[model samples]
Target: MSTIDIIGLDGYENAYPRELSGGMRQRVGFARALAVEPEILCMDEPFSALDVLTAENLRSELLRLWQAGDVPTTAVLIVTHGIEEAVSLADRVVILGGDPGHVRTTLPINLPHPRNRKSALFQQITDLVYTILSEKDYEVSPDDIAVLNQGMYATFQPAPASDSFQQAASLSQRKPKSSRSEPFEAFETARPTNLDISEEWAPNQDSPLRYPQLPAVRIGSVTGLLSFIAEDDVDLYVLGQRLQLDVDDLYPLIEAANILGLIELNEGDARISAKGQRFVGASIDERKHMIRIAALSAPEARLVAQIYRLLSQAAKQELPEDLIFDTILLKHFSPLKARKQLDIAIEWGRYAELFGYEAPTGTLFLDRGDEPAE
Candidate 1:
């Protein structure tokens, strides 16, 4: 009964699963998870199925209870894709990435209780996490986050560039040439020592490469983000509020823009790059040309360029969209994850005019190029 009251399902205790709304069902899940009084509570995308308001409400309730010492667990471990949620809830945020899923870096969240997402310090802290996760800096000490709580948000020390991944170029079974009508710059990368073949996309192996990991976000939203900033510096927290985006919804958009070289992040502010200003001003055709050049330059999956290169190697210069999944994305991600990643890649490629697709048949092929503008 106490658990029922805690989850707001007190009167629905006797109700069957089918009799309750989806949010109610989620509340019941919370009740069950809490009933046992486990030492460490684990939640995997707990609110993913709930509507936005319900998720917010539930998160609020849980936060309230945790602060009040009503939560039974000694620790709460959440595996989430929401960047802000992690920062909001944890004392320490552990980010995991790469093919085999290693800890990219862990940072301390030193904010006071009942955190304010709108606080300037909060925004800067979130940006630091984004920086670590985006740039894939493994050697970065956890102490890096210490600067934020000390009121020093201006500068960041990028640890020395570590060894490059050996899997990117050397693992390619053959050096396939781009066969498009207007050929693209080759996927120029250093050959590391290995002959491994796997479906997971490799990060860029450029000798001096230092990119934030590609946030799992789509090209459309990223374009929208660029349009939102429009050549001005905007506070990221206010940016989130103006867009009515939760901390998580806006992370990908920010990371994508930063990684694509369209924006620069500093002290919780996002400043549009000169390239971004041009992207905002360019004609539709010109935008595609620019994105084509930028995205291909992305080391993460060579997002657009690599796909175009692969299609060229195909006998028909095209293949079922799912084929890329089997050959490149699947070995590292589950089918659903692979599909989501490929879908975004397809969206960006199609938007960049790097490739074309037939949705009904899931076919992906090269799109004719208008040479990218300088």
Candidate 2:
């Protein structure tokens, strides 16, 4: 019976008995016991020597082997002091009470596999188990009660602002000096020698440029930027709701990018300018380079470039419709982080060019060199 492949212990059979730890010896003993392929496998505190994490792993492995039909046992009987271990591994849990250890009650755990810890049923069971354990004769002092009360009070206090402070500090460090000031001053000071024809054609305004800091990234911003470019018109309120953002969080970045000549906003419509178009058209590596450049000259444009890169990377094979927006949020940023970045992107990132496709009513038409823009 001890010579079988139970728990795959055959490979370690050559080791001297003295060399094995208590846990290893117990495992070997279990394997040897199962070698007989008995009708029933009985374990008396089998995992008593193993740590909690290791015991859980071993238990899972044993369950897997049982499910695989290798074990001939009709049933498994295990004795353990741990209620959680019993609840996790056993089909029926028998609770013993009294100093001599007599059966108090038998509990049938009807919960399905991969039981949810957050479920109400699990919580109820946990509370019952805790109550049963606490019922055993134990002394409680005023000091203990005071300590417990202190712990409860601590929970209600707001958590320290270290994380938020660190984030703000890091963002401040990453922010170029110009992002906080008038971007046009820097742009005029270092005007490019080879200005594009479109830049020369656009009218210049003397409006006081207001640069609002972006809150964070958003999914709606990506969709809105795409729509604004493609449709040439979008409702501010509708776009705000789509991106799960407020108008206050969305407008600043958009306006800033417009001021920096990265995007154009006219007739209640937002569109990417020629400079913005070139940046998006560039390769991923090149886009990042342009982003740094835009950030120095215009932080809003830099943000827009980053959003476009995220969208491009996310939409690998197919256009990432609103359905996959959450996925992108999770992949690139945390739920909290996503909200922040998206808010920033929408507010600052330049819009892209969007093109629509329509089929003729009766006849099919094909055009060359007119690929639809994503």
Candidate 3:
């Protein structure tokens, strides 16, 4: 009767786990926990999977038990990503920070019991928690991200440029050019005409030979983010906080936008640029043109262009995807990383309409529909 009163699972006690809905199963689990009569109950993401109404009801019932001193547990500790949920339930919220993750801060929620979500005090505390979580000291340096076209999986780093001629001579002697064929030769020779080989290889540049991990987000997401920012001037950290985006989810989008000159980040504030504004206003076709123009600066774009040129020159407009996968990407990256990089390249290329990929046929080709910009 006590369990049924708390969880409200009256007639469905006999229902198996497989037969019950997710919420019903969750309620059953809670009832089981209460049945254990433990002194302390610790829940990790307790309501994360439930429907909004069900989660709210469960929270209310738990609070009822905690306030009335009905449960065996004198204390309840919940680990949750939801800021609002924490503010609603916890008397004190302790946040963990850093790479290894340590105690950052413990915040006390002073709001009265049965907190009203719409109240200004609740909002204020929620915002405070967000500010604390998104502390500016944790910001990622743009330079810390690696450069593209560099070999991430290389066994040895190249020595100083003074040793380059000697290294090349030794390499030439050690391995004859005749032994390398097809894909390897093609990939090596596919360097863009406009690419500055000397500049890329210059030893003066810091970490020039490191591979860049591309943004995990798609072009639509990039555009959507820009449009979202264009509506208002926002601090990057605060914006991320409101959206519940962590460093990993938010930083890459910022980096990608920064690289394309679409958004400017100044002291953690993100504002859409003139180019970004134009992009937001443009039609689908014109936006593709913009993506092409901005993306030209990337090494991946140049490499794709080079490949397209080679294939066109050979009167072979289409090439098997496996050829490039094995020769170029796999040489520098692990199979997983290579696939990720290839997907990035594909996204960029398709946005620019520089190339088309047919997954069914496992082929890549220059898209004839994408004519030169006027």
Candidate number achieving the greatest lDDT relative to the actual structure: 1
The TM-scores of all predictions, comma-separated, are 0.43, 0.34, 0.44
Which 10-residue window in model 2 sums to the lowest lDDT?
A: 159-168
lDDT of predicted model 2: 0.44
Candidate 1: residue pairs that collide: 134-212, 134-213, 135-211, 135-212, 199-328, 204-299
- What TM-score would candidate 3 get against the native? 0.44
Give lDDT tens digits, candidate 2, residues 5-124: 445343233345653445446667777777787898999988877643235335544664554465778899998887656755666777778778787666666654333344455455
Ranking by TM-score: 3, 1, 2
Give the best candidate by TM-score: 3
Task: List residue ranges in candidate 1 displaced over 4 A.
Answer: 1-218, 230-232, 369-374
Better of 1 and 3 by TM-score: 3
The digit string of per-residue lDDT tens for model 1 on 207-246 reads 4553223467645456556534634568899878867897
Ranking by lDDT: 1, 3, 2
Q: Quote the positional error of residue 106 for candidate 1 in Å.
A: 60
